[model samples]
Target chain A: MEENNENMTFENSSLAENTAVTAAAVENTENLNAAVENAPDTNAAMENSSAGSPAETDEEQKKPYRKIPKGLLWRCWFIFCFFQRTCQCFDRAYCNAFTYGIMPILRYLYKGREDEDEQIHAGLMRTRNYYLCEQSFSTVVFAIIIGMEEQKANGADISDELIMATKTSIMGPLSGLGDAIHGSTFRQIAIALTIPYCLEGSIVGALLMLIGMNITPWLTTLIGFPQGYKLGSEFVLKLLQSGKMQKAASAAGLMSMFIMGGMAAKYANITLSLTFKNDYKEIKIQDMLDNAIPGLLTIGAVFGFYGLIQKKVSTNKLILGTMAIGIALSACHAMGY
Target chain B: MSSTGITLLVAFILACYYGFYSTYPFMILMGPAGMGSIIGLIIGLIMGDPVKGIEVGALIQTMYMGVVGYGGVLPVDQFFACIIAIPLAISSGMSNESALALAAGFGALGVMIDTLWKTINTSVWTPYIDRACEKNQYRKIAKGAGLYPILTRMAISVPIITVLLFLGSTAVNWLMDNLPEWLQVGFNNMGTILPAMGFAMFVSYIGKKELIPFFIIGFYVMKFASLPIIGMAIFGAFIAWLVAKTDKSSDTEGGLA
Candidate 1:
């Protein structure tokens, strides 16, 4: 399961294309014919329809390539940011959000074309497939895809398969790292750092926590989008391969581990009530554990659950199990065990 | 301000909070530590006890530290727990244990509500998007995808949370009041123990065997020296930097060889 999920990449474009053709035929055959005629070739036309106006794509191809406008890039960033989780469906997952977010860029690329609608409709339908990843860190993927769209608009040899493959291949590894860094580690560090202050009756704790939580995601999006667009997908692949990404992830992990230890020590306060009567006096287990280590129970709880998690125990099960153990211990205490 | 006005104000805050929750900038307000604390503090101030609000908020935040919306599956809805529990804690003078129990229990319910919201988006709004896409209506697709999901969630969550706040707060207090003493103690103990799960979840995701020593070092240091969290974080950062630097040099050497 882990192996399968780690390298997961969905690519069934032929299926999508077939359905799209049928859907388009049923909806409006005349419009589809107009789109095909305006298109340079059927394949280029199909790819072209998803972006820039196919009619003008030839003219735009002749003109000098202009760098995508700063305003357009900004619009792309904000749209994705705002609508990344929009209209999530059972079928397509994040496809709706992707389509919605990239609309501006698509329109810009396909601008002033006779078959602009058909082209955009094609583009939107192409992205209408399974896509799930850490939202903020997904800026890089969106940027790269936009770059591909721009290139395709300018008559690059980019295929729909290439674009879809890029989206699928990159998103998985990125999501894995993103989930670890932004989703888990960074969030824990923020909470750990701010919780103490929060417990102390200071709004600073809450304020710092908000700042801590927001900064990584905001900065990642801010930096990732522009850099991703400039460097393109090849650069991201290079970064992934260089092992620098691993080193950086490890560094972040190390910090998170240290903080987790500190947090567990300070916060986890489960106490045991087990005792044995030896006639002289009842020997208490909690004291013995404390004598061995101050927060032994807490550490034990952490590692025990960690082991369970590594063994693929679902989080909900672990949560229930922890609650059950806590309840049982309470019952033991009630029974004077 | 009148209690009614305060209730209305809280309702508005919660409405905005949950409505734009998945939207960016608004997404920043999604975390328990961030928005949860703010909401707690706001409700606390409204109740003439900002400190209590902060404390309760912090507690919820701490418990939910490692909870992530991984693959869009939230095992527990800490945000929902926060909105419900903070108000209950402040208004009904509920015990922290009871408040936590309410948070945990209702948190499960919150997940169901979240699923329902997503389902509604899929079922109700998605068809419009598909139709819009087929007909080449860009504006309709944008509105369907971007605007409708949020507004729909607002429509669903706002009324439900607001009603829960006004009516459910006292009712939950009553329920907690009636729970057996042992169960209450069990819940209190559960609250204490739950944060361990947070840390455990934190480590399980990020932990590597090579970094195990850092965890040990961090634990023992905190046990003996009891350094503040910020100080520990700084120390950890320094160690991480050193380790990364050393590892990079070794990698280069390995490549050269």
Candidate 2:
């Protein structure tokens, strides 16, 4: 089994190496194409194009002279294109993906240095100890770090400590931002918009939910990547300090709560079928409860579970307890409780 | 299609969907709302009752609507539950409610599998990548980070899903045939109450002290007024906007509280 596993790893690594080589070739062709397009005249373009022989370009010029290459950014985005939850280890929550995604950019930045391999190794190891962030929303953090890496490689006197500290500090705010807007608010709204239609068996509703849930995350990644790289971390710090995000979060929280209330009333219907005989009327317990307060059972049940969750009772246990109680209640009702 | 072919096809779909959940495009389909509806639709179509399948799927989705697996920690695997429940409901002619109850249990099982996978990746793949980092082998690191997990995940999910689908159908059929009627009704009641837990989880998540009133107000208004949900959502957004504007004026006076 060990041998087979090793063999498979070897084959996979070879395949990945081939891809990397091809990617480098593709990037070179693109750069050359750009250089030709930008030249003032055809002769200058020919001279620029002929400045390097094909063999020399392959060996020596694979790494671009620019501080931050467009190809490297796209490569980072592609690496991030894979599910961010790909290989989560207990010790390092998301550091594996983080380090892996940034590898190409680091390689490009540190390419041709005195200790290129050593610098790459240090760069990977620096952030691999611990990382936890919202995958799509945290694209800004990745962009800022890549920007920092570029500066550091170009002799900007930036230390490894500063990079590490930036990562450690920025993740908390970004994760909170992501959790608030995307996780708590947009997700529920998407479901709210689609659930009614889906209940009617409309495929369009399902597709809408998919699109709605995804737009923000993808948009954040696409827009944040370039802006974060250009503006660096200060832009994010300014935005946070401006109190705009706070106000938005508050508004979103309010909207989420309101929508949640309506949804709970609409969907969280828990019917109590217990009824009793009275002197002059057939009294249904459900009717009495409804008369007192509309959707009272649903409201009570929601708050009850909310209290349990607040107490930090594991959701799994609550689900089981609910099922048990529900079954037991059904059995009692059958026995005319 | 033959039963074997159908089984293989469904098994393949589940495995691919579950295993490649984090991959591009598939990540969009990872949520309970998205996965449940699609899975329910597919299995329903297979059973020649597409609407019923969607109804079951929507029920599960509603029950799990508020569940956000933030930071990769699944509170319950609603998608896994749908996979188990929808097929059973469609194939064995079981009630949606009982199938939902059955799904609630399997959701826990899905979490266990996820935990086990994460643990294995921690002990095995993480160290392999660490060693590759030490050697400065980028290709090896990518393999450990990307390729290997998907393969191993497929290996783990395929057999589990296949076995569950084949055996689960029989088990549900037997339970339906032999279980007392009251217990079945109990399961249905449980399903009805399950959505309460979803809303409860959402309320707990978003319900700060100041924000709690909105939920109550939203509930009662929804109850009494009988307004469309979309219209209510717009009113909520407008009210929220007004609140923010007032709060901003207060913040200007009080200075960043």
Q: Quote the positional error of residue B199 for candidate 2 in Å.
A: 0.3
Tens digit per residue, CA lDDT, model 1, B176-237: 76977777777777777777776776676564666767887898788788898878999999
lDDT per residue (tens digit) for residues A64-125 in model 2: 43466787797787675563567876788878787788898889888777899999998988
Task: Estimate the TM-score of every prediction.
Answer: 0.81, 0.83
Which residue segments of model 2 deviate by more than 4 Å? A1-65, A278-281, A334-337, B1-6, B22-35, B38-53, B249-257
Off by over 4 Å in 1: A1-67, A273-283, A334-337, B1-16, B22-50, B176-178, B241-257
Error of 2 at A84 (Å): 1.9
lDDT of 1 by residue, A1-337 (tens): 2232122212222333443443342332333333223222323433443344657667655665545798988887777766777677666677777888788888887887677777777777768767877777688889878877877765666667667766766676667667766766676678667878887668878778777877777877788888778555544544444445555666777887887787677766667777878969988888887887777777787778778878988656766676676677777783212
**Pairs with backbone N, CA or C atoms under 3 Å apart (clashes), candidate 2:** A83-B22
Docking class of 1: acceptable
